[model samples]
Target: MSKLILVLNCGSSSLKGAVLNTENSEVLLSCLGEKLGLPDAYITFKVDGQKEKVDLSAQPDHTGAVGAMLDKLKAMGLDSQVGAIGHRVVSGGELYSDSVLINDDVIAAIEKCIPLAPLHNPANLLGIRAAQNIFEGLPNVAVFDTAFHQTMPEHAYTYAVPRKLYRDLGLRRYGFHGTSYRFVSEEAARFLGKDVHNLRLVVAHLGNGASVAAIKNGQSVDTSMGITPLEGLVMGTRAGDIDASVYEFLADNLNLSVKEITNLLNKQSGLLGISELSSDCRTIEEESLNGHAGAILALEIFSYRLAKYVASMAVAAGGIDALVFTGGIGENSDIIRTKVLNYCEFLGMNVDAEANLAARFGNAGIITTADSKVVSVVIPTNEELMIAQDTARLSGL
Candidate 1:
């Protein structure tokens, strides 16, 4: 069988597909279909490094999107070599610890997880069924985002709530961004010339939706996000790490329902709520440099919380051998990295300003002085490639 894996990340209205060759880590083709079920639905394709955008008719859905992309592949004569279809499913919810071949039973298990990831899994199921229809006779694999953190022990993922909630409802921490963490941690170890099994690290996966993970001996020990993505990090719009009583308090004071309060925290809060500006970190950083009070405060809080979480996560790393940064803000923002590492004096991280600036924009390099106790490195994340690798392995391609 060919080593090509078609990795698909299906959002509620967007689908991102990539054809990657695991042997050489080359992406042969990639595409994005967005605004499905809307009148202005469109899809973009990139084959041989050139991108083309195609506008769709009114009310295009997942099946339509898949068929369109498959049509492109067939035209390019690349469809026949696709070995398997890999899917990115969020919130495996203790049902899966690693990537698995997709079958009827696997589909059912994924359906059971829809309640846990209502915003994501349904769309994922739609994509799976669409792929099964359009890419008939090809093997399908499911690579879950929660798989890597499955190694987390009970003490690390447990809640302070009642036993009934834990046993009956299965409410506990199940961190997201496991794929990015897995990819970057191994890459960081490779860069350090150390086997991952011997390295202790804390990684901050900072982006619009962000989280921190503590990996010791190359296994996840603890993570910041709990039960849902809304639980950790000051994200673009999410008010992470808030008190549970805020729901009830808001319901009383603002005359809002529990659902409305939850929506506000997830959609209206975070840096946007605090700054009343925009959710984009770049914008916030620019405004802060211009001396905007709210933006300045937002940046300060974002950096401080990240530093505090890194310090807390270092305990799980046993002590820190290195602190690796990935994702959009983590990879490209020298300002953010400098602010965060400056607060890590207790952890022995002395950020080298010149090296920190040089590491931005797809450049992977050490951002700390050679003599610093904990080495700091910036590495960009490749989650789709990770998904493709898992799919290729699980599908026996």
Candidate 2:
């Protein structure tokens, strides 16, 4: 049987799985299980470009979801072909700097970093355990989103706070979206027909959870996200880079606890808070076109902050040879792209209006003029493929 690698990215309520041929990176099957443990739980799978949906009569948890996914693969005679499993672990802490084989010690280390990623590590552990149970004796690899950023310099990852805090605890910047950044940076270099090691690039991963990174010679030099995913560019619902004093201010005036304030920043702020409407950028754009004041202001803040971060990342790279955009919004939203590029005109990044509009629908193309100093291109990210490749290599597939 041909060897295949299984990639699993688990969330608190969702699980995304993909089976890819180890030799070539061709996806054999991909599926998503959503609303797990809820009445509306459903699993959608696509194979050979055909999609099918299976609705669970009873709410299924993560274990059940993985079982259903594996059962479907077995029905297609792919169970025995799956030689390894790759899991997307959100936070690996300082202990793990690269993808590693999952074992009891690895699981214990992941559990130890729970406080660093209270929301994601547990769900990742759950997926890892479930896959281990179902596919006994098979190699399972843990790919961390924070692993790529481990290359950052001490000054870049360190906070301005007390030294003891960072020494005693890992209170330092650990950027996220590293998997996407790594894939897109390499793709950007390939698209530019240049060696990544000789390039200085800035990558903006704009999605529900957005961030920017400075890639110096193909390695992450600095990134927008800090110790948590909540820090950095304003996201769908996250209040990024807020004034520290605001916490105490809200506590005194709104009589909110620290936990409540954290919740507000993480779930109730950003575009949603500014516009007092939906967090979806498409909806905000439509409202802005219809003369919604709040939406207009929200978009302005989002684009301005993004451009500011892009410029800052360029500084971190010393200079930028190319600026790449990827992720849901960065890959699709021409309006947002135009607005951000307009602010970056000072950096000699000129956008070809037609090309900007043309680079949509999963098309990867340059959106900047030929003579522009900074190359701007949109490349859709495939984090699953990256995970599969890592898993295959580490597991000796």
The model with the greatest lDDT is: 2
Model 2 quality (TM-score) = 0.97
lDDT of each: 0.91, 0.93
Q: What is the lDDT of residue 154 in candidate 2?
A: 95
Instruction: Provide the TM-score for each candidate, comma-separated.
Output: 0.97, 0.97
RMSD of each: 1.3, 1.4
Model 1 accuracy (lDDT, Cα): 0.91
Clashing pairs in 2: none
Query: In candidate 2, residue 371 scores what lDDT?
Result: 88
Tens digits of lDDT, candidate 2, 1-397: 5689999999998999999886676888999999987877888999999999988646478887888888898899889888999999999989888999998999999999998999999999989998998888899999999999999999999999999999898999999999999999999999889999999999999999999999999899999999899999999999999998998999999999999999999999999999999899999999999999999999999999999999999999999898899999999999999999999999989989999999998999999999898889999999999999899899998
Model 1 misplacement above 4 A? none
